[model samples]
Target: MLPEAKYRFLSEDVKRRSGLVLGPEKGYLVESRLAPLARTEGLASVEAVIDLMMRGDKRLCEAAAEALATHETFFFRDKTPFDLFSEVIAPALKPSRAGRAMKIWCAAASSGQEPYSLAMLIDEMSGLRADILATDLSGKVLEKARAGLYTQFEVQRGLSIQRLVKHFDQAGENWQIKPELRAKVRFEVGNLLDDFSRYGRQDVIFCRNVLIYFSVEEKAKILARLAGMLADDGYLVLGAAETVVGLTDALKPAPGQRGLYVKADSGASAPVVFRSATAAA
Candidate 1:
């Protein structure tokens, strides 16, 4: 595979900005997403593309970051977590919502599907309410998320036919999510590594499938920050393949679940040490 010398500096910038580590394997992805953009602007090659990026053009910087990050996502991409979100997490947190409204954040929401799926689940439940803040590092994906458009394959992967009919309408050959459902979601461009001072506290955060790209050190930093963002009784949801092993002690596996972790109570915030590498058991 070719080293991404063309966008190395910008790639480093993305790592600094978002904590998403992109190595050589991602060179094709950058070339693929940005080559056309470069050609359209009459630039010669990927080196020229990086040159434009280094010049501090905000649009190029944003575009280059979007190019390197993966945006492939679907509604309820993995069903078990959503099941856990609805069945266990929400009910546990429901009683805590006496007079205050609940807030759920999708920290790495890609193209809005995960968060929208969450909103749809809430919509299905009567009076069990919450607000959703879906954020991604790439404004391009967030814009697509706000648009609520989906190709047939994108809609069918995890979205059930019944829910599909209820929440989407056919627009020519594509599906468009209903305004009522789409309106419930709020999309923003956010980097999980940065101080989330503006995002406030949350009851649940779905940061699934985004951590695999980070170094273990980066993952630890991101997890520590997420631990702070959770309210006393909040939970953090990670991808099935992701783990909190070296991250922090504030999270422990939800009882009877393999990939889920709940925030430990106030006194339990100390770092969890292990005697063995197999400590996850």
Candidate 2:
């Protein structure tokens, strides 16, 4: 168990750096997540790791905070959101911007699965084109995402056998995403706490599942920033359990869409985008 002061410092430092709220009850998580980092740094114990951090070792402190980030993801996690993307959003773009590619940002794309799943869905959309920019806070996970390699267990989690065969090539005991599919996503290291306006406006922002770690105020701040960068007609996809209802006024939910949000006063009716200009009219 970590000493109370050390625990408080660690939690506060992590929240300051990553906006992740690690409550006092999450001590087990801190210990587990920091153990490998501790071992790598040749620390005698997790306490020693905290000791170095308390002394303000910048590099170690950064690594320790990053180590606590949750990267749990799989291909097409929570299928319905991707379904809405393909069925509603894809067809919606066909009429107004049929030939032009749309921009999609996977704001917390861990290890590439969600972005790759969307890339595959884009391919299935007849005559549709899109660019995917997937970002995460962890360089270690981004490296794995860039490689697009997955073990059998990893591939099996959310991928159907047909999708597995169609999109991945066998690599001994593992599977690698096809080069074409791999080219569809560009992965980068991004911290939600940092400025990212350089990536510019996006038509679809998949900032799913990561916001639950933040306080309500922090969630509102992040959503407001995201709203600033979202095209008026664009969609902001959150995890099913997440909602902007009490957090921010900048966004309103897409009626009947479980995790979709859009800009307030968006052209998309009731914040649910139409399939074509005619449909909107």
lDDT of each: 0.80, 0.87
lDDT of 2 by residue, 6-66 (tens): 9999988889988889998987778767876787899898999988889989898789878
Best by TM-score, which number?
A: 2
Model 1 lDDT tens row, 46-110: 77877777777777777666555646678888799899988888788787785666899999988
The runs of at least 3 residues in candidate 2 whose Cα sits more than 4 Å from the true structure, single-residue gaps closed, are: 1-70, 268-281
How accurate locally is residue 206 in candidate 1, as Cα lDDT from 0 to 100?
A: 88
Write down the RMSD of all candidates, one decimal each.
9.1, 8.3
Query: Residue 162, candidate 1: how far off, in angstroms?
Result: 1.0
TM-score of 1: 0.70
TM-score of each: 0.70, 0.72
